[model samples]
Target: MVDTATNRVALVTGGSGGIGRVVSERLARDGMAVAVHYAGNEAGADEVVGGIASAGGRAMTVGGDVADERAMAEAFDAVEQGFGGVDVVVHTAGRMVLGPLTDFDLDDLDGMIRTNIRGTFVVDQLAARRVREGGAIVNFSSSVVKLAMPTYAPYAATKGAVDAVGLILARELRGRDITVNAVAPGPTATPLFLDGKDEETIGHLSKMAPLERLGTPDDVAEAVAFLAGPARWVNGQVVYANGGIV
Candidate 1:
């Protein structure tokens, strides 16, 4: 068991499922007291927390809409109250609406902007203020930003905003010893990615990487663990976890 003497705390948004779930569990295994944040899936969040506790790690669940500033502030407060103070925050909450730019529903665009863009702002704003010195903040972007996939325009636009926010926030933190970075994963084997994709499409995307397979949630989690823990020198950048896709 890793020693918990350092008292590191982490808040993982969307920690109930997909990439966020693995990230939460990995951080817990690293000895951080984790606040698993979920927007609606209480059962899923509880399952993650339970798994951590079963493995002799400490964790709890926090729930709220990621884009709601007040709700997120409360979520931060809850983590602070539970684990002393937050040391790391991984904002994995996001939405993806795929369609050609000209044909995309305006409402779908609006939702993505709110969840992916505004949500990052809200979470990072509080993380900037609350995360302790020597801490880290990781936001999620997407390899699609570089892949420039046809229907991914709307989703990629939001992640493009995330990339910008992460870069600027790292510089803004200055001497605070907080590293800000974004992790962009490509064609990961998550429920979100597999939801609408057919076998042929999935196989094509899996083979896009030189690795010749879809990334696992654990694969992306390892990247997040590095950024959240010992990667003090890696700041203000996007670490693409896409297996050499770009």
Candidate 2:
């Protein structure tokens, strides 16, 4: 068992699937007591927790909507009550709505704003107030903001807001020794990226990067783990984990 004094406790929002799942597992392997947060995916969260346990790591599942302040407050309380204190918070929970700027459905845009923009605000508010000194707050953004891909305008706008939040929060927490940063991943092989695309489209995107391949969940998780653990000097930055695609 890892020593409690040295083991940090992390609460990863949207920790049940895709890149979030890999991030939760990576943090656990790094000797953190991970609280895997999920929304309407208890089974997936359980599987994540079980995987961590099976690997001789400590983890638990927490459920709530990321945009709900009361629910997220209680979720934070649960993590603190369970593991003593929170040292890292990875806000990976988000929603994506693809459409052109002119014809984008207002309803879909509203939903994305609630989950991606409002959700980041709610989670960051708690993390800023609660996360221990020397801890880190890593928010998920997207390289699409830089790429300016078609049909991704709304989604990119949400991430642009996230990037702004991360940079501002880092300065806001100036004396706390905590680092706030955002990870903007590109063309990752997650359900969020692959769901509606055809094989031909996927293949084309996969080769857009200089690496000539789609980034895996683990690829992005490695960057998050770095920011969460050892990358202390890296703050208020958006580190794009997109294989030089930007």
Candidate 3:
């Protein structure tokens, strides 16, 4: 066992991009020493770390494939060696390959399952071991699971698995005072959403929400920060951070 301290340490998987980047920055800004983990985007991870540093916060980037257990272990090890025991883990690493279920390829489905469901289990297990008492674990899910939108079957299947895993993990950590929760974000305007779509398509989708706009990284980050900080009473729940998109 490592010596426990009061200062908080947060490890954010997928911290190099999208909502992961925003969450890492928000947590760091809130005075937590952050571990920014990226899968393949080292430069992007460095950029996030630099931004945090320039903002007078401490952070470092560690890269690994979240689907690999050994890699996740080393990533957690780096965080512990650099800061201390982890106090929070926000799992935002995910991949999506969308198509109608009738035409969806099994290979693509397998890939999605491996990255989203299996990867979350691996990360959460490591987090359960590494995080200290009073720690928080925030897992990412998609509001599509609730909306059951078409062409999102495979993706939502994985998130549905995530929801189940996260809820069970929360109860499993009951005596440890660690809270595990999942955030389901809808129509976030991240690179993941904007990388290929035309403006017209994006606009049409944005209007589907009651807020009548796409969500932002900062919007999702705020939810993560809440779960990581003063939301100790909030446990085992899948909170939708979407702008009433469901």
lDDT tens digits, residue span 138-203, model 1: 999999999999999999999999999999999999989899999999889988889988999999
TM-score of 3: 0.96
Which clashing pairs does model 1 show?
A: none
The better-scoring model by lDDT among 1 and 3 is 1
Worst 10 residues of 1 by lDDT: 1-10
Flag the better candidate by TM-score, 2 or 3: 2
Superposition TM-score, candidate 1 onto the true structure: 0.97
lDDT of 3 by residue, 73-133 (tens): 9999999999967999999999999999998999999999999999999999999998988
lDDT of 2 at 39: 91
**Which segments of model 1 are wrong by more than 4 Å?**
1-6
What's each prediction's TM-score?
A: 0.97, 0.97, 0.96
The C-alpha RMSD of each candidate to the native structure, in angstroms, is: 2.1, 2.1, 2.3
**Full-model lDDT for every candidate:** 0.93, 0.93, 0.92
